[model samples]
Target: MKNRWIALYVENQVGVLAKVSGLFSAKSYNLQTLTVGTTEREDVSRMTISVKADDTTFEQIKKQLNAMVEVIKVIDLTTMPIHMKEILFAKVFNLNNEGKTEAFQIAEVFDQGGNVKIVDIGVDSVLFQCTLTERKNNELITLLKSRFKKIEVTRGGAVAVESISSSCR
Candidate 1:
């Protein structure tokens, strides 16, 4: 099985998200994560989608995606190693000293200093933001240890491009 990070440079238009997601669903492609937003160019949007599929099936998906009229570019951006990261926002219940201590520990471990933002908080819960490598994030989950009641966890898809090598320049 091959895990792919595909980037689409597409024209921004109606139903684009739905159409793209539908295509993935129809083709039975498993999308592990995704991020989409308008690019610097006003008329275009960039989408980063991480999907898991076999090599042959991935090739077919690539061909079909490239054939779409709305797609100006379709890049299978997985092979090249690059800076890949995901941001996760987690909400944990903050009830007592135990809760506060555990939540602080969790946040300290996950937070990349000020880069991660704490968006909101309630009387019983604390929301925290974290940016780190996937491996660190995966390890962070183990620290939860059932002490804090996790309210929610959200993450953005990995965004990366081909790393500049000495030979490339």
Candidate 2:
């Protein structure tokens, strides 16, 4: 199955997040990523969700979400032109001077116009913070894992918005 994306407008109420996530769990639909935050309107929240499913399953998911009372609107974003990014933090330990330099070089190479940077550095560890598309973040993580023996990684779910003029994904 390929990845599908949806944007949900929901009431900003307590337990709304839990109920929305529970629906996915109860249906056994695998949610790849889910990020939610309040919109400019304080009473509403926007959620960007990613799931891997076939076309039919994806349609069902949309229908189910639309039927929920808390869900004000559901927009299918899979084929839409949108800009998306996920936050990633990676720390590599047991690094010497050369290894630390290598880490800096790697961050520079993946900078994408300054979206990646060395956020912290210690005698034996270096932390890299990156904001990039999900695919790019995955590639960075893979490279870091291959190059370092002791590493820790944390990732935030992707957030996306419709492109204003140009097409992007």
TM-score, candidate 2, is: 0.98
Per-residue accuracy of model 1 over 20-68 as CA lDDT, tens digit each: 8888899888888888889899899998888888888889888988888
Clashing pairs in 1: none
Query: Model 2, 1-169: lDDT tens per residue?
Result: 9999999999999999999999999999999999999999999999999999999999999999999999999999898899999999999999999999899999999999989999899989999999999999999999999998999999998999999987788
Best by the TM-score measure: 2
**Quick one: best lDDT, which candidate?**
2
TM-score of 1: 0.83
The TM-scores, one per candidate, come to 0.83, 0.98
Which ranges of candidate 1 are over 4 A from the true structure? 113-119, 164-169
